[model samples]
Target: MRRRVLNGEICKRAACREHDMHWKTLERILTFTEPPGYRLSQPRGSKVDPFLPIIKEILESDKKVHRKQRHTAQRIFERLRDEHGYNCGLTIVADAVQRLRQQNKEVFLPLSHPAGEAQVDFGFADVLLNGELTKVALFVMTLPLSDAICIQGFPRECTESFQEGHVRAFEFFGGVPTRISYDNSKVAVGKIVGNREREVTKEFLRLKSHYLYEDHFCLVRRPNEKGHVERLLDFARRSFLVPIPRVESLEELNEELLRCCTKDLRRRLRGKSVPKQELLNEEQQRFLSIPEEQFEAKRLQTVHANSLSLIRFDRNSYSVPIFQSLQDTASASMRSR
Candidate 1:
């Protein structure tokens, strides 16, 4: 079709009109011009083709063999080459095996955590308390859906501390998460055998039994697996700890931590304006619930020689009358109280 040009001339095609039009006139009409000499280059490299089936076969054989000492890669490679007549190079086989090992590191699956699915991790933070410089390990549990955090300070990271932190976290959040994801800390995972089996610590096993919930440990040397809790620790450090320079006591610091987590950080953002607490409430319904009764908090038991003959509860020890019968009746009364 013929089209009118800027100078009142007519052309049959736009390209013909452009060709006929003055350069300055065309420049005025056209807002932009394309730059010349643009070329697309194909990617160049010796592509290492993946032997997927061979890699899978090797992994399957390794898993089935079950012989600890006999399943070495060198031995497996010899078997594959000599017995199976596989023509793959040793280096190629080794590389493929390594890739498969990495792939099997964390069995990535679509994990849907109910409202109450939470992850716990310990982070180190410095705090000034009552004019004393204190290095405290912060126990942090993050509920992913709500971004709700529960934080407590401990002198050190230990199994007892972790168990205590769990109790305090549940109390602070007013509920417990269905499942708690953990790092392979000595407190949780004792040893990782064959990329699948884990020897968890006794205390953590007891805690899981008492809570009646599943505990998952991240793959060895992979902290990013528990990224949520790690990020939550960063949040707690900035939003809660950094702002508060001084705290009267550990209890006071914990109280402030709870407030910051629930009141400040738990609020919804502008883009996704859904309160964390509300999201957590929904998650709780879908997630596992805490037992009706709280798990009994662990206490250190010490048998001390006392001149007064008494049993200690907190700091104070109550006398058990030296002349009283040391029988079933006395034991029953002691337990009842």
Candidate 2:
């Protein structure tokens, strides 16, 4: 059929002539001209576009929300109809949302942490806190760029321990990092619903607000997201905890850890011209200043009142206000050492 057509034949191929291929499509195939690259402009007077900005905002905010909690395109269309007086079809909203999601993923770039940025994580180790060999959770924070680190020990990995670790670590550096990266530890995160979005614990939130430092969390199981602290945890187990110094209390041992961390800065890291400590010293100036009033990191424990309106906690009797009943304050809790 091609030979006859090229030879000036009448080309009586009814099957080919009956096809729906347009002249532009045929021209591109025959002459090898490139097809038009741009999409056709949206027609004027289209109501679908007036609601696009609203849809984009909703989708952008949805990235922080749990997948299950997110509104479906149908739900969004309904919201627009009810709230924004939108009169578009469900397909329009769905298609727009799908396309926006694709564009968002394509445009996303890996973020870089500046000098006053750090990563934090926790690990468990055995130590003699008070002449008795005990296992304790250790908090590790790292300046990833300089590779300087701070490690502190705690009896447990609760919010109090977490808050203490940050305060002491910032004091150890004489300043606080502008932003700290962390894993989804319960001390820092109340709930991890979807992707990078999280519901931070109340105490951690208070601590963050108090310090005025931004906090970022790694995705679950992806330690490489906070690789510095992950590496610091292993390094602490090997180098810092070696020969286990027996201190009088956890406090003394944490102080020693800070000294050791400072000593570590004397060593140079890979691809660095100067010692790690020198780099850390220069960067510390950029860190945010410590607050005048420190955050009180405490656990809120609920205690019930007895017949005499006295609440017993830790084998100690404390008088509750006679006006407040136990039943009335069943949901109340407090922080105690």
Could you tally the backbone clashes for each prediction?
A: 1, 1
TM-score of each: 0.56, 0.58
Q: Per-residue error at 9 for model 1, in Å?
A: 38
Q: What does candidate 2's lDDT look like per residue over 1-337, in tens digits?
A: 3345456563434425756555554444444335556545774465678888998889888879888998788888899999999875888778887887788774434556689999888899888767888888898888877788889999878777888888888887779899899888777788898998999977788888898988888889877778768878899789988887788888888888888888888898778899987888889889999989967768676888888979887468999777656545664543321
In the predicted model 2, the residue pairs found to clash are 265-277
Which pairs, if any, clash in model 1? 115-283
Tens-digit lDDT track for model 1 on 135-182?
Answer: 888898888777778888887787667898998887767666777888
- Scored by lDDT, model 2 comes in at 0.80
Predictions: Cα RMSD each: 13.8, 14.5
Query: What Cα-based lDDT does every candidate model obtain?
Result: 0.72, 0.80
lDDT of 2 at 22: 59
Error of 1 at 147 (Å): 1.4
Q: Best-fitting candidate, measured by lDDT? A: 2
